[model samples]
Structure formats: structure tokens, C-alpha cells
Target: MSSNKITLKKIAEIAGVHRSTVDKVIHNRPGVSDAVREKILRILKEKDYQPNFIGRALRNQENRKTIAVVSSRVNSEPYLHQGIQQAVQEVGVFGYDVEYYIFDIEQIDQQIEMLYTLAHQKINGIILQALYDARIPGVVSDLAECGIPVVLLNFDHPGCTDALCYIGQDSRKAGRTAAHLAKAFLHGSGRIAVINGYYEKILNIYDRCSGFTAYLAEIAPAVEIAEIVDSSENAHDLYHAAVDLLRRQQIDCIYATSSGTEGIGKAIGELGLQDRTHIICHDLYPEILRMLREGMVWATLSQDLEKQGYLAFQYLVYYLLKGIDPPSKKILIEVDIRLKENMPET
Candidate 1:
């Protein structure tokens, strides 16, 4: 454990405290005052002390356990894949073999079968995002009954007792933020349209849309929200939907609760309405990146997708091995507003 070489006595000496005092603070006992706790923490940080994660892994029977990251098909959205990949890579050093399984959305039955197969294969953990099924609680219970830890990402399964923790942004808050942006950009009231990605059944979409609607109804009473429109999770459909809505309603604001911002940008530009109406989108994808740079989209509610995936697994590891609850419950990634001048190039 060379990497974790420093002893509590050494840290205590530097912190000007007795070994037992330091130990009490380290274990979060109430005897240590907050001020002393801060000082000791400062010393630990300054010394760059890192625990022997490898040694910790070797001691646990589940060391080098397999973690499966399951999601819908990668499709055209490379950002989703990138974020999940980066998360797994970041956690790989801790002795978790992270493998991604992209399932066909239409064949959910097959997907369930595949997961069952993996369950028999000795999967230690699962990080799931993108598309939720109602039958999830049963499956999750099955895994928990077998001692596998489950971490739900992006979406929450209400009755799933097996979900150790859920780490992601608040869909409802993002919706409220979207509403505020819509009101400001529309200058009070204008016919606004919202576009959603294709969904057979999913929780994120429902939550996001519900939040958006609820917020707008409360804050901007006069703003007319257009009827529900679905774009088949395809960029082309998204572009056309934007065009149709803009042409018909002279839409003063547009909100897309999914990953179709790039297509939306194109439609807005082609109609020469980019300068007229305000556009707001979710997920700061490559397409959305450009619109934000061009002032086509006024603001974006970014959930830091990479961080979401990374933290989900990180929390799962904490619970599975350490026997501790995650530091946060219902983690809401901060909401960030991006404008034309402030948008960073991806």
C-alpha cells in the first residue's frame, strides 16, 4: 500500500492534533469541532493523500467485478456514447470491467432476455440509462435478490427498491429553467412549440415535459404551448417538425426536450427565422453547440451527461463495497445557461 503510505499519526503531527483526535475526525465522530475537522482535512488535501484503491479492491470478493452499462442504440447521438465511455474508463482503474450493451429499442423483449443472460454471467453491477420499462422493479429485485447492485442513471424507477442510488439532473428543474428562458426571450407571450423525441415508453421525457408544462403554466400564463409533437428520434424528422411548427404558428419560441437541437437549428435558419424567434434546447450536443454559438438557440439546459454517467457508477461502487449510502440523494446536476458569446466549442 505504498500509495497510501501516510499514517494517521503522521497526518496528526502535521495537523497539530493527537493520533486519536485525528482518528475521531477521520471517522466523523462528534467529539472533533468543525474547525479542527477543517484543519485536518486541509492537511490531508495538501499532502495529496490517496487511499490504496487497488488494495481495497483485492480485499473485496467482488474485486475486478464486471459492470455493465446498458443503453438504447448509440444511433446518431455520439455524445451519449462518449459520456458513458468516459465514465467507465474513469472507473476502470478501480478494478471494474465496464462493458456497454446497446439494445434495440423496438425489441425490448430481447433486451430483457439479454440482461437475464448477463445476470447469470456474474455481473456485479449495472448502470442503466435511456429508456425505462415498467417491469424494471421485478428485474431490479431479481438482481438485488442475487446480490447485484443497480444504479439508475438519468431516469428514475419509482418503485424499484433495488436501485442503490440515482444520479442525474432534475428534469423538472430543467423544465422550469426552460420556461423562464422561453418567457424572457419571447418577451412575455408568444405561441411556443415543443418537440419531443420518439418514445414507446420512457421516464425522462415524461418528467421533463411535465416540468416544462407545469412551470410555463404557472409563470407565463398567456404563452400558448402547442400540441404534442413527436420526431421519430431522427434528425430529419426533427428538422421538418421545427419547420412545420414555425411556418404554421409564427412560433416566437421553440423548446426541444430531446437531442434534436442540431436539426432544429437547421430548420430555423432555412426559414430565416433564426433572428426572429428564440430557441432553447436540452443536451449541449454538437448541433446545439453551433446554434448556441450562432445565437439561434438562446440558452441550453445542460446536465453534464459525462458527469452523470461517471458519478452514477462511482456512487454504485461506493455503496457496493463500502457499505455506505451515496453522499447525495437525487443529485441534480446544476443548470447552466449558454448564450451566443459564452458557448464553449466542443
Candidate 2:
């Protein structure tokens, strides 16, 4: 019915029979009842169908496309990992194969090179989390030159070539939105300190911190911005940094824009400052989600992790197969503000 050739499954729908029944009828397998067989034959003749358009017979003729999912340490972030895994699951059902590739977020250059090296291979598609690097434009160009399509997840790499289609939320805008929510919850007056996992290194963290800082400064100038605590991938380092920072400042509010909330929560609880300070962070990890519902964290900003993974695969598959264009320069997903009343229990 559509411009694309109708599949046998579609024909089966028209005949009101299982696709296998259609297959058995077409191949003369003799499993159908006489009436059903006659009905299928009539429908097949009406459609004038002569062949199975999609099957192992045509598999090799079409490219057995390989989609590469390159992500950060997904194991550390459950929801993000879930999103990536869900996208991987979608690949099998959609007739594409996926190869997962991951690297440490700290090793930005190495991660970029590894992605470029994969371009040298037969991979037709890439799902990437764009990191902070000056060479991303060149890397994007190389992938485009090699006819590989790339879909950016979560983070946006500026100066990317035309071949890059981004399917994740706008990192900076997500940050800004979180800041406004923080202001609303805090009532725009308090000394708030910001906790960012990759302060100077990650674009998403920087943008979120920036948005939070800007909105807080605009409506709540009286509220002092205490020093920003730089979170670590190392648990011990993060706990000590947050604890020591909290010890020195009269921090009445805290905003976290990354997944380093576990250590921060422990440190905050150890200091017994939950009564005085209102804590707000991002992501819906098991710990963070529990903290939000338990009133340990006053609120959290969430982006749809599953939706991100699902859309990332969709864009990469589209470009790799049909060279279909993406809709926008950057896709921005809405930020979710979770309060004690609205937070889900894990």
C-alpha cells in the first residue's frame, strides 16, 4: 500500500491469517484447511503478489547494517544504561544489528579517536555521546566522508558536520530549566552551592551549571552562590570534596547536574545537614530516586533516559539505511522536575 513494497506480514493482515500461514500457502506446505487455503489464494491473487520482498533471500542484497552504540560508563548510571540497552533491544526487532562500545568520560581524546577508528571499519551507523573536544568537527567530517551516519546521545558537539543527527535533549537548556525549578523550590533566597561531576570538562554539566547560576542570579541576587564542588568519578574523592566544602560554607541549598549524587548524599547525611539545606540534583538513579521520595533530596531534574536511547537508535538507523535527514540542529527533550510527592519509589 505504501511506496515501499508490501511485506508478506502486511499481506497476511489483509488475508486475516498468520504470516506463517501465508508463507505455508505460498510455498504449498499443505497445512491450511481447504476454506482458509482458498481464501489466502484469493487474497494473493487480488493483490497480485509474486514474491516475499523481505527474507533471508534478500538479506545479503541489502546491507546487513551495523550500528555502533558508543557511550560512557553506562554501568555506573542505571537509567542511562537502561536507555542504551532498550535501544539495543530495538535494533534486533527492527532488522539492524548493534555493537556497543564504551569508554571512560575522562579519556575524551582517546574516546574520540576510538570512535574515528571505528569509522575505518564496516560500521554503517554510530550512536555517540558527544563529549568536550575541539576535534569533533573533523571527526564528524571523517565519518561523513566514509558514509557513516552518527546520532548524538545526551551531549551536543558543536561545529559538527551535516551528517550528524542529534536525538538527545539540549544539555544547556535542560540545565537552565533545572535552575528555574531550583529557584521556585528554594523561593529564590539562600546560599546555594552547585555540585558538578565534570565541571570544566563536560558541556552538559557546564551548561546546566550556567543555566542554574544565571537564573539564580537574576531573581535571587541576595542569595549567595557558594563555591562549586567538583565531583569525582572516584567515590572517596567525591565524598571528601563535598563534605569539606559543606563544612566550610553555610550552604542552604545544593544543586547537582550530574550522576555523582550517591557520594554527595552520603556526605550530606554524615554531616547531618539535611534539615537545613534543600538538595536538588539530576538523574533518577536508585539512590537519587529513593532520596527524592525520602525527603533527603528536595528535588531532582530528570531527562527521559529511555526515550533518549530509543530515539538515538531510530535516527542512526534512518540515516544509515535511507539517508533520511534529521529535523533540527539539536533535539531538546523536556526536563522533569521530581519532588517528594511526585518521585517514584524504586
Candidate 3:
């Protein structure tokens, strides 16, 4: 028989054994003799039989699984949200339901409480955008002890080593790329100011800023960072911060390590500094794209947020349904530099 048409029943007939015995051997269950198990294994190997996990899931409705996606509300970038929506739709076909538990960035207690709630709810897996809090590691450990697997999404915590894998961009490398862009824009030396997004609360933002500063120092020591301002990852706050910085100093470039590019672009436009100050920011918000087209922003870096979201969910599904682990512990998404001329048509 063809390998593609191999089945447990067919294998039982060939081996002169009952289907239940074949099932026990296939699933590594006890009660099967070693001779019979080895014979079944040999046939499986020779036939190259592959289990259809989707079919199994479809047939077993009582074994429906739930995956929890937990994150701070502030980190919901648009593309990331879209990717998660897509994952949710796809997983539903395999009898898996995804539950979202979003909390305010400041509410560490609430985030922690939600994790405890999920633990009791019998969550099979988790996709987390981890906060930079001291208490997170212990909670993640508690979940692992309960046999629930976690896949880190977007932001990662070093303490949560129990997580199956991390799926996101290499923030430091993205920062280094930003530094290269800054040097090229400024012709090797100029004053650049950095606006960080929730710097104290998120580890990735800090990593991005550190990468930018270190790379810039190594490549062009003369390109001074005039100021580094921390702002909420929103346009209004970023606008006020940008306006204050622009009024006090003559900045040649502004590198924003997070969202709120619109505010910086607005400040540069209002002060008539667009001709001199080049603005580089992260992500592709609708307003940011418009800013690029209008020449208010120079370029933006994209961390492929949609792919990050999709993979985080899909990886957990594979792990839970097929007993498959991700290919690596650290899955880094590619960073793309977007300019006005090459921005997506949408």
C-alpha cells in the first residue's frame, strides 16, 4: 500500500493485531508487548506514516483547547492586532479558541491576577507580550509547573526562561539599523534627539534605544544625542514633548524608537524645521505613512508585527496539538526600512 494511504486499521491487519493494540503502540501507551511494538514501529517507519492532527482534533470535539493571549493594552499596534485576528480565525478550524486578556500597562497587579485566572481556567497554552516587571517570572514558572506552555510575543522578559520561544524583532539590531540611517541622513555627524516610547515600562524600547546609542557612538562619535525624552506611545504626548525639545535645541535629526511618529512630524512641520530636521520613527501607522509622503518624516522601520502575531499563535497550536516544538527559542522577525517612495500602497 502507498504510504499516503496508510492507516492504523490497515497496519493492524498487516501485523495481525487488533486496532486498539496498534493504537497503544502508536501513542506509546502500555499493555503492548515489546515484540509487537517494535514490529508496528518498523511498519510505521517503512510506510512513512504521518498522523493527521487536524483530523484527530476535528473528530475529538470534547478535547477542544483554549489558548490565552495576554498583553498590556498599550502594546496593541495595528498590524499586530490584524495578525492575531487572522490566527484566531485559522485556529478555530482546528477546534481551538483564543482568549485575549489585555490589561493597562500600569496595572501589574491586574495582569498578574489575569494569569492566575487563566491557570485555573485550564488554559493549554499562552502567547504573552511580557511586561518589564519583577514578578512575571514567578508567575510564568507557576504556569509551566501546571503543564501550560507559553510563547513570548513582541516584548520578552529574561526571567521567563521557561517560555517555549520568543517571537518578535531583534530590537537592538533595529536600533542599530536606525543609527545607520541617521548617519546616512546627517552625513556622518549631527545632533540627533531620541524620543522613547514608555521607556521605563517596556524592555524592547530600552533595548532599541541602547542599540541606537551604542551603534551611533561606534560609527560616528561626533553625532551627539542632544536629548533623550521618554513619552507615552501616543501622538498627543509625543507632540508636546517634540515641541518642547525643538524650541530649546537645533536638532538635525530625531529618532523615535516607538510609536507616535505623527506627533514628531507635526512638531517638525509646525516649527518649519522639516527642511533641516530629519525624522526617523518605528512602525507603519496610517498617519506615519502620510508623514513620509509629505516629507515630514524621513523613514520608518517595520518589525513585521502581523507575522509576529500569526506565528505566536500558530506555534502554540502546533505545540499543543502535535507535540511539536518551535524550531528555535528566539524567532526574530525581519525589520524593513520604509521610505516615501517604497511605502506600501495601502
Lowest lDDT sum, 10 consecutive residues, model 2, at: 52-61
Per-residue lDDT of candidate 2, residues 88-140 (tens digit): 55444234666777777667777887888898888877877756788877887
Residues 26-97, candidate 3: write the lDDT tens digits.
554558887887687667666666535334433444666888888877745456667877876655546677
Error of 1 at 244 (Å): 2.5
Among residues 3 or more apart in sequence or in different chains, the pairs in candidate 1 whose N, CA or C atoms overlap within 3 Å are none
Which of the numbered candidates is closest to the native, going by highest TM-score?
A: 3
Better of 2 and 3 by lDDT: 3
Shift of residue 139 alpha carbon in model 1, Å: 1.1
| TM-score for candidate 1 | 0.78
Instruction: Give the TM-score of each candidate.
Output: 0.78, 0.79, 0.83
Going through the candidates in the order shown, the clash numbers are 0, 0, 0
Candidate 1 at residue 290, lDDT? Answer: 77
Off by over 4 Å in 2: 1-63, 74-78, 91-94
lDDT of each candidate versus the true structure: 0.73, 0.71, 0.84
**Candidate 1 C-alpha lDDT tens digits along 15-134:** 888999866554444487868876876666556555453334333324467788776763422455566566555555455666778777676676677667778986888876646778
lDDT value for model 3: 0.84
Best-to-worst ranking by lDDT: 3, 1, 2
